[model samples]
Target: MRDIPVVLSGYKLTVVEPPAPNTRDDGNGGQVVVTDRQGVTQFVVALFAKLRVGPGERAPKGEEIKVTLLTDPGLGFEEDSRVELVDPRINAYQIDSPDGRSISGISFKAMGLKPVRAPREEK
Candidate 1:
């Protein structure tokens, strides 16, 4: 897997879904929370991102991305709130299934996320 660094400065990110525990099916009809290599629980946060563009430029495109976090995002990340990802990165993966089908795509991950604060009006 190749890890790629992501630059988010050109995009505006809005929370679509709050942070939730990432889980996987435990073999025996049970769900288990996923954790990172450091034993920190992983969380998934869905965000809607729109590219910032100047006037007359191509219409800013938008996409929804789910980011995996190695730690809890604490508080203040309510739905629809503007946020920024901390230490965001992407990984490319390819898995070949037994049926000769290939699955491949990029996955997003981050250390955490924080709510974006509005700038105060200067006096």
Candidate 2:
């Protein structure tokens, strides 16, 4: 079994259509420019959410980012599960477990897409 570690940030989520599974060619065909929150436009894929992490400090790798999808707290969540990157900029997302339970966790590092830019204006 392959072990993948991850970090999480607290943020709510709303599901969006999933991306194509192995379609990594960013320049596959005619692309379109899309507007972002920072007032800048760029050619990009439609965004979506996959998980939700609660408020607080980020979790360290190997640490489980607790999530409570149900009204009850007795049912908890695990880390490193398959989560969706709902918002590319913030890395916000949500996901459903194998048992059909829903939970959200920050994709602060979705597939390790780190070194992410700081939206220019902030710089």
Candidate 3:
């Protein structure tokens, strides 16, 4: 699992549906934030995101949604963390955690926009 930096610098956090590519203007998917964790930032990807929901209804509606960058374990999530939902084009989603430490499962079929990574700096 590569470490990808998930940054939330100047992006808005919302649970709206992600904009369609041919619908309107190009929407900003999710942002990448790089923490102090080693080999953790490389797992960041705009195509996928993590959301934390409540445990009341099987399919909760009108519930609060938080979006956060996530890592890929190829099977499930690596940890139980809180995430925020940006962009209005995104529908609803769930996070799958198997090892509870490396990656989470996301239904990317409903997602439209993905975070675009900035160019790396040259030494």
Candidate 4:
């Protein structure tokens, strides 16, 4: 299925883990780096997403998701830093096993990520 675009305006994203190279195991017991169609290295960034709550609303709920980036998100994005996903999209996938088991879920991908600066207080 085609990826669905996601708008995150109502949610806050925080980096739970720093960026890391996305790789797969090669047959020779080595790891092969994963890249996009354009040959740009892909990276995985773990983020914690929390829904914004209004007055009298229930407690905020959040979930952690690892996003695949087509290219590096650059510096300044570190663990515990607030961030925003650039051009985020969600794709649904399912894998069937020979043991009659199956796994299905959504995956997240993004063009990049940027740090979200906090608003400055006024005097």
The whole-model lDDT of each prediction reads 0.90, 0.31, 0.32, 0.90
Put down candidate 4 lDDT per residue, 1-123, tens digits, no spaces.
666999997888999989888989998999999988888899999999999788788756799999998778888888899998889999999999999999999999998998889869899
Top TM-score: which candidate number? Answer: 4
Residue 43 of model 3 has an lDDT of: 27
Model 2, runs deviating above 4 Å: 1-6, 26-123
lDDT of 1 by residue, 6-62 (tens): 899888899999999999999999999998787888999999999978878984669
Q: Which 10-residue window of candidate 2 scores lowest in summed lDDT?
A: 68-77
Location of the lowest summed lDDT over 10 successive residues in candidate 3: 106-115
Better of 3 and 4 by TM-score: 4
Clash count, predicted structure 3:
41
lDDT of 3 by residue, 1-120 (tens): 222234443332233433212122335765444432564432222222333344562432333333333333232222332223233322334455676655434222211223334448
Model 2: how far residue 63 lies from native, Å: 24
For each candidate in turn, the TM-score is 0.87, 0.19, 0.18, 0.90
Instruction: Give Cα distance to truth, residue 123, candidate 4, Å.
Output: 5.6
Better of 1 and 4 by TM-score: 4
